[model samples]
Structure formats: structure tokens, C-alpha cells
Target: MGQQQDDEDREFDIKWADGAEHKEPSARARMLAARWKENPPGPVPFRGEPEGVGPRWSSWVSTAVVLGSVVAVIVLLGYVNFRAPY
Candidate 1:
């Protein structure tokens, strides 16, 4: 039925907004850049993809190291409150 087809099309639009199957580059771009850019907008969401805003072994690791060091310092300070013998 016509109503059912329209519903399906609407559903597809919603899925695309949710980062589902993506669209190919346009013809106008081919004349200009001659390249089909991959996921130019943002991180393409695929199932089972772990948390990442960059490529492998990058800033995330460095940030984690710094945070770990900070926590360690806090824990160590609690063990010994600095109070000089008077």
C-alpha cells in the first residue's frame, strides 16, 4: 500500500540519523575533488566498536596514564598527612 511505503521511507531516514548505512558522495564532488571521502562527518558507528575519538594507541592512552598518576598521588597523600613534628 502507498501508506506502508511512506512509512518504510520514513523509517530509513530515522536510521540514517542514528548513523546507520551511509550515503555515497555526490556527482558534484567528483568533478571538484575526484575523491569519495569516507566518513567525513564523524566516527561511523558500527556494532561492537569500543569507545574511541581517534585512531589506535593515541591520546586516550596518554590521558589514562595521566589520570592514573593523579589518582595514585591522591591515594599516597592520604597514607601520610604532612605534619611536621613540633
Candidate 2:
């Protein structure tokens, strides 16, 4: 089991050419970056202060949806009548 585990943990060998050269960015990539610098996209806000009770309103909506679902289920079960036959 130890030998099998060692073999599983072993990494495969890779051979790289000695004459390989790193290529610079193309003209199109440079142009796009320059244009973005001139006029960037709008910022995306992940977390910020709610505007005029916005956060509280959304929380109330979520709570209402959950409670409404529970009440609906209870009403549905009340309408269901089951009988046992022997």
C-alpha cells in the first residue's frame, strides 16, 4: 500500500526546449488596454450602504415570501382528509 501511494503521488516528467523564447503582447492587446485606460467600464459594487431603506425593504420581502409559503402549506394540509381502512 505504501509503494502504491508513493507511485500515485509521483509527478510526470516534462521536457522543455532550450531555444524557446517568450513572445511579447500583440498590437491588438496593447490597443485594447490603451482604450480601456482612456474610458474604463463602470464599477461593480459588491457591498455598500442601502439607499433609503432599500436593504430593510428587501429583507421584509424575503421574510414575507417564506412566511407566506409556510401558511399556504398549512392551509393545504388542513384541507386534506385521510382515512385508514382495515
lDDT of 1 by residue, 1-86 (tens): 99999999999988877785666667887655644364345456676556675556779899999999999999788766665344
At residue 43, what lDDT does model 2 achieve?
Answer: 86
- Poorest lDDT segment (10 consecutive residues) of candidate 1: 34-43
Which pairs clash (backbone N, Cα, C closer than 3 Å) in model 1? none
Clashes by residue pair, model 2:
none
- Could you tell me how far off, in angstroms, the CA of residue 41 lies in candidate 1 after the best superposition? 27
In model 1, how large is the Cα lDDT of residue 31?
A: 50
Provide the clashing-pair count of each candidate structure: 0, 0
Where model 2 places Cα greater than 4 Å from the true spot, the runs are 1-22, 45-60, 79-86
State TM-scores per candidate.
0.29, 0.35
Against the hidden true structure, what lDDT does model 1 obtain?
0.75
What is the TM-score (0 to 1) of candidate 1?
0.29
